[model samples]
Target: MQIYPAFHIDKKITDAADEALRKAQPALKRIDEVTDYNQQKMLAAFIHCGVSESHFAASTGYGYGDRGREVLDQVYAQALGAEDALVRYNFVSGTHALTVALFGVLRPGDTMLCVTGLPYDTLQSVIGLTGDGNGSLKEYGIHYRQVDLKKDGTPDYEAIEHAVQPDTKMVYIQRSRGYSLRPSLFVEDIEKIAAIAKRRAPNCIVMVDNCYGEFVQKEEPVAHGADLMAGSLIKNPGGGVAPTGGYIAGRKDLVESCSYRLTTPGTGREIGCTLGNNRELFMGAFHAPHVTGEALKTAVFTSALFEELGYAVTPRWDEPRADIIQAVLLRTREALIAFCQGIQKGSPVDSFVLPEPWGMPGYDCQVIMAAGTFTLGASVELSADAPLRAPWAVWMQGGLNFHSARLGSMLAAQSMLEKGFLG
Candidate 1:
């Protein structure tokens, strides 16, 4: 049964959460200020494009004359500080958007360099490391090279210096840690690495896999120097409203090329109807900044709570947060399962369901995901996932409301205690 906080809540944990909320007031205020700035910018994009009620109408057949499609692109471009953007419900997930961006800019025989160590696991197959029996990048003749992060998990600048050669047509940077223990990259870090890529390989396109890193900060990776950026609508940009989609924003030509890849050679951005998703897209963009603030606060609270309980957390409570994600090193499989199961207890969607680790595809090991989101796989609506591998970590992200997220975290703690993993 679901434990409603209205009557059956634990006073001790609630009191601690209240104290934490009080301590986080200042950071929350700063978040609101930046959110307002971003909101205004997005609104201006809508106004500039002359959005109308009919823009929300769905279209069919090559999606010709879809005004809503155009406006969304404009809104996303402005919001992400890019010259152009392609925001569509068609691209599916973050990985699909990233694949389009990579395929659009990279031709056969081009070498791609990853400066931020290994990328998210999903990209491994896309890059042809695995599942390359089909039309993978390497199957098309693209070369891939990686400059692993230093022992301390920082960018390997010397390795990057040596790796950015003439044939390196694309240099990749993943802003989020993505199953890794390293801290997520902030704009400053993106800038530092982007500058090196530009200086060494001036013609090489610098692309950022921007999943889970949008709207949490005022500025985006495009503003830092990335030539192209890609992310999922269900993550941060959707503002917990958009049902499904992905976005690619950056330089005009690069964005256009991505659109071409998304559609076809002659079609490009001119096609792909909104399919009645315009309203959700606009509303999501408008609410993304505020929603992101809530998620960030929840992450802050989670960090402090777990740290107080004697467990170490990556990017500690008051660290410079670049994303909503908060990783707790549980160190044991028993603790990991119990912790995630506890979070499921507070979920409105599946409060009674227990999450178990399984062999989820696109990942090496059995992974567990606690995604009781309002929109299926919406990460911005509060969710958690971690691969049941060596580190035995639990990665938590998003919180529609801080209170709800707090309850989940507290429940997670209680579950661990009940299992004797912690007491």
Candidate 2:
């Protein structure tokens, strides 16, 4: 039966979606289990922190002794299994939070090692991988080095061990797959890397760009040995409700150092004002695990449906997932555009808009994006984006609910079919 009577979806596509749902049952069930565990963890943190109506009250200028801000940090720290956390609406993005951690921990003579190869496009300039060194880590005199991933797109453990130096102050790991075809790093992988780095240099900090990986698994990177981790609130912890912010959680000392960087060296985390954002931030954190589960189900369904349609999908439907991203190799420019446009069409907001490829800043080439979310640029709200380059693939993620996400995936297929991009 055609489930979406309001829109046109080919019978073949509908049938494929049904079969895909069937194939995704096991994976969906696992997502539910993880969601339950994470939800419980979040609940415990809230209750233990004594989160109440008072903590939701806003603060103003200098925000001296803001109870909500302070308790927000405690709640996040407890939830992520970290010694401390810095949660702030001032953090413009996940990259900003990571930058604070990097600058806060490393000195001019120190070295930073990346075990996950090159980072996301937005981080290229920050790390001086692209563009002039200007204000990047490179310009600040801190040495940066990367050990490329192996041929199979997995971390090169041997290379990482050899790469760590006596002067290495930080070992970086990006938990998400980014724009690459590599697998997302799980907490177990983080544990091994942390162990290896600490063994080589006892003082080295293992930092994870936890971005899209938050709440997707039963445990976070901090629980498995990461000394520090950072992520954007808009992505996962936002629960599709947090207006804007980011978080950094990990070792107490390291988190303290990051706080200094986030504000001023002397003031640190003590003075940030929550203004009118405390309630939504708290509410969002409370709902994150469940929202993340919905996104995971959407990703699994996408993988299964795309596979049924003969496209290659990473972490195929039944495979274990470490993040919400679902990469589908459309293999052609037209198909990619069609898929993104279709996703836009299925969005609750701005459904009539058409997305086009443009030279977005912080990227090497033209990139296309489709996001009609309530929150701008929220990847946790069913958005598809891809760089216009070789091996064209669309990275899709986020869906507040499974039903809406499933319909979006089917609409993507329908668009491709109408354009004859699908066989």
By lDDT, the best candidate is 2
> Which residue ranges in model 1 land beyond 4 Å of their true spot?
1-12, 15-19
Expressed as tens digits, the lDDT of each residue in 19-94 for candidate 1 is 6666766776776777687777777777877778887888887789888888888878887889999998887899
Q: What TM-score does each of the candidates earn?
A: 0.95, 0.99
> Candidate 2 — what's its lDDT?
0.93
**What lDDT score belongs to each candidate, Candidate 1 first?**
0.85, 0.93
Could you tell me which 10 consecutive residues in candidate 1 have the lowest summed lDDT? 1-10
TM-score of 1: 0.95
Q: In model 2, what lDDT does residue 387 have?
A: 98
Task: Give the poorly placed runs of model 2, Cα more than 4 Å off.
Answer: none
User: How much lDDT does candidate 1 score?
Assistant: 0.85
TM match of model 2 to true structure: 0.99
State the displacement of the C-alpha of residue 100, model 2, in Å, after optimal TM-score superposition. Answer: 1.1
